[model samples]
Target: MTIDTQSQRAEHSPLRRIFGSVFAILQTRLELIGIELAEEKDRLLGVLFLGLDAMMLATMALIALTALVAIAFWDTYRWQSLAGITVVYAIAALVCALKARNGLVNSPIVFEATLAEFEKDREIFRKP
Candidate 1:
């Protein structure tokens, strides 16, 4: 009679099983987090755009009022000084807008995290 040496198989170590379960949970959580982040990013972009539009409309209103007021007080204070102040305000607004634009274009942590989540999900689903 031959010995049934091949009948028994080694079980996965407890540590290995725990690690695998932890990894799977972490990956699933990360994917959920990524989707949330993407949604948040979209929301942020929408708010930013709305704010920019409002700012532009307000600036235009202010400029029109300034023009009317300057015309009314043309004989008292120099129009040149009023124009100079408007120029300064415009410059400041420009600088702030540029900084905001830069922040939007450069920050990619949200997108990166979303991409990583997608990759993990893909790997998980691809397994046969």
Candidate 2:
């Protein structure tokens, strides 16, 4: 009579099966999260560079146009036009700076949604 030891050894314990399944799920989720992060980073970087380039080019164009305008009116109102532009831009800068300062000072808390979810989880866990 032959012993059936091979079949017993081939069968996985329940704990091992559960642990393996959990590990596989965690690994897959982590891989998916990593892929999503990479995609988001790539997209943000592309947008940032494109926006910066466009803004820089626009600023240069504006400066050139301002110079052209001043040149066109050089004989009559060159200094006056420059002075008017300077005052307008200075006021705009001051307003923008004040708004930025206020925004930085009064910004809401970061990760608000995550904090809310964490509180909910804590409440659920605390209930038993």
Give one clash count per candidate, in the order shown.
Answer: 0, 0
In candidate 2 the C-alpha lDDT for residue 56 amounts to: 90
- Where is the poorest 10-residue window by lDDT in model 2? 1-10
TM-score of 1: 0.52
Q: Candidate 2's residue-wise lDDT over 68-111, tens digit each?
A: 87998899999999888778778976997898699779976544
- Residue 76 CA error for candidate 1 (Å)? 2.8
lDDT of 2 at 93: 69
| TM-score quality measure for candidate 2 | 0.56
Inter-residue clash pairs, candidate 2? none
- List candidate 2 segments past 4 Å from native: 1-12, 87-128
lDDT of 1 by residue, 1-128 (tens): 13344333223466677679778777877777877787988989998899889989988987787887688778987677587768978898899889999988997565666567667866976898
- The lDDT values for all models are 0.77, 0.73
CA error at residue 21 for candidate 1, angstroms: 0.6
TM-score of each: 0.52, 0.56
